[model samples]
Target: MIPKESRNELALDTFIKAHPHLLEEMKELSAEDRQQQILWAFEDEAESRGLEAWELALELIAR
Candidate 1:
């Protein structure tokens, strides 16, 4: 099985790739701000879809 940390990393990567518009939006921010925004957006998206943040990340990786 994948290590938990690695799984989360992969999930985040998959999530980012699936949302190219996020990258575009992030480009307007400083590195730290971009990181924060991405995390917030990720969490918001997961919540909107009725899944826990990590659950949505893993689901994205699965796809």
Candidate 2:
């Protein structure tokens, strides 16, 4: 089984790959800041859909 941290990273990677426009919008930030922005955006999106962030991450990676 994958470690939980690894799973989360995979989920985030999957999320980023599926949304290239997000990367385009954050091109000016440092890499760390860009990742933080993406994480917050992902969480916000999940909240808007009434699901926990992990659930959205899972759904993204599953696709």
Candidate 3:
């Protein structure tokens, strides 16, 4: 299963999609690199929201 933090980051897909440059950069990454990037993004967002990494993941899955 993916970590909670990872799920939160994946949720950014909408925002990422809205930014063509970011989307292009994301598309150019290898699958593994992309996954890591997403995970880190989640961590950042979770920190900003004052939510634990796992909490974000649970929230994402619950949706």
Against the reference, the lDDT scores of all candidates come to: 0.85, 0.88, 0.66
Off by over 4 Å in 2: none
**Per-residue lDDT over 1-63 for candidate 2, one digit per residue giving the tens place of the 0 to 100 score:** 777788788888887887899999999999999999999988888899999998987787677
- TM-scores of all predicted structures: 0.82, 0.85, 0.58
lDDT comparison, 2 vs 3, better candidate: 2
The runs of at least 3 residues in candidate 1 whose Cα sits more than 4 Å from the true structure, single-residue gaps closed, are none
Candidate No. with top TM-score: 2
- Native-referenced Cα lDDT, model 1: 0.85
- Pitting candidate 1 against candidate 3, the one with the higher lDDT is 1
Cα lDDT tens digits for candidate 1, 1-63: 889888877887887788889989789799889878888888999999999998997887778
- Rank the models by TM-score, top first: 2, 1, 3
* Model 3 spans > 4 angstroms off: 1-24
Looking at model 1, report the run of 10 residues with the lowest lDDT sum: 8-17
Q: Backbone clashes per model, in order? A: 0, 0, 1
User: After TM-score superposition, what is the CA distance of residue 11 in candidate 1 from its true location, in Å?
Assistant: 1.1
Per-residue accuracy of model 3 over 1-63 as CA lDDT, tens digit each: 767556656655543454456546688789888768766776786789899877755665666
Q: In candidate 3, where is summed lDDT lowest over 10 consecutive residues?
A: 14-23
Candidate 1 displacement at residue 5 in angstroms: 1.6
